[model samples]
Target: MITDPARLLVYESDGLTAYRTAPRAVVLPATTEEVVAVMKLLHAEGIPVVPRGAGTGLSGGALASPGAVILGTSRMNRILSLDPENRLARLQPGVVNTRLSDAARPHGLYYAPDPSSQTTCTIGGNVAENSGGPHCLKYGVTSRYVVGLTVVLADGEVVVLGGAGADPY
Candidate 1:
């Protein structure tokens, strides 16, 4: 957690520079459990939480609301698992979209989204925006490739949605 104004200023905006707002604080949780813990505290205190992923969002989605807490996902980057046979990958929301394809190359698999900012934009941001790129003409956006998600609700409840199998219903 960071309360220093100077440090917090760094997260005032995402890639989009037109809009900006300094967060009351910035928290970079390294794991989902840590994120949940932080959310629990924030919820109890009634502080708003803004989730950020690499700050590569072109829409200013990473920009914090006034007095809100910026929850940066950069430190949480990690490719947790890959199943080539099932054509699925499970990962931390902070994982860069391109990195997933790079790691899966050896398995003759690749995540299809190719947003211009793929090298830096994170999966979480992609999901949040339902982003698309050049390849989207052929493969569509993040939602098409995302088979499952582990979401931490505002109240700090963890919910797993979907699965590796085709029927992620």
Candidate 2:
């Protein structure tokens, strides 16, 4: 948790500089358990949580509301699994967009979404924004590539939605 004002300044706004809000604090959780614990505590206290990826979103979706806690996923970065045979990957939300492609390149496969900020932006942010870039003209948006999601709801209930061969509902 980051309560120091100086450190908190870095999270005041994302790529969208027009708007800024100082969160009450910032919490960077490095694992699913950590995230769940944080969410549970915040939910029990009636506090709001604003999820943040790499802070590269131009949509300002990561802006923290007053008294909200910035739940940053930066520390949870890792490419959990990559299977060239099935053309599948299991990655932590904080994995940078380009990193996925780089990892896949050796297998002659690449993640299709190529947003301008791909070098710095996160896959999690892309999912949230349904982001698309130059390649989208042919490959479509982020939704087309997403296979599954493990989401922590507002009340701290964890839900797994979609999967490799299952319908996304």
Candidate 3:
């Protein structure tokens, strides 16, 4: 937990830079288990939780509330699994968008929807905001490449939405 105002200032806004709000605290959880634990503790105390992914969102979606806690996904970045045959990759939300393409390039694959900020934007933020870039006009957006998600609901329940082999259609 980061209570230092100097550090909390970093979580005040995102790439947009138009809107800003200082959060009460900043919590960087490195794992899903840690995220869940923080959420449970915050839920019991009635503290609001704001999920942030790299702070690269151009839409100010990552802006923290007046007294909410910012849960950054930077430390959670890890490529959990990769299935080249199935063209699937299970990654933590903190994984940079370009990192995925870089890793999959060795397998002769690449993630579509190349946002201009892919190098710095997190996949989780892209998925959450349905972000896209120049390639979107031809290859669609992040939603198309996203096969699954593991989300923590408002009630602090951890749920896996889809799987590597799960059919979206």
The 0-to-1 C-alpha lDDT of every candidate, in the order given, reads 0.87, 0.91, 0.88
Q: Compute the lDDT for candidate 3.
A: 0.88
Candidate 1 residues lying further than 4 Å off, grouped into runs, are 166-169
Q: After best superposition, candidate 2 residue 82: deviation in angstroms?
A: 0.5
TM-score of each: 0.95, 0.96, 0.96
By lDDT, rank the candidates, best first.
2, 3, 1
Q: Residue 82's C-alpha lDDT in candidate 2?
A: 94
Give a tens-digit lDDT track for model 2, residues 1-169. Answer: 9999999999999998899999999999999989999999999999999999888888889999989999998898899999899888998899999999999999999989998899998988889899899989998999988889999888878899887776533
Q: Give the top-scoring candidate (lDDT).
A: 2
lDDT of 3 by residue, 19-129 (tens): 899999999999888988999999999999889998888887888877899989999999999889989998999999889999999999998877888898898889888
Off by over 4 Å in 2: 167-169
Q: Output candidate 3 Cα RMSD.
A: 1.0
Model 1 pairs whose backbones collide: none
lDDT (10s digit) by residue, model 1, range 77-142: 888888788888888988998899899999998888888898988998899988899979887887
Write down the RMSD of all candidates, one decimal each. Answer: 1.4, 1.3, 1.0
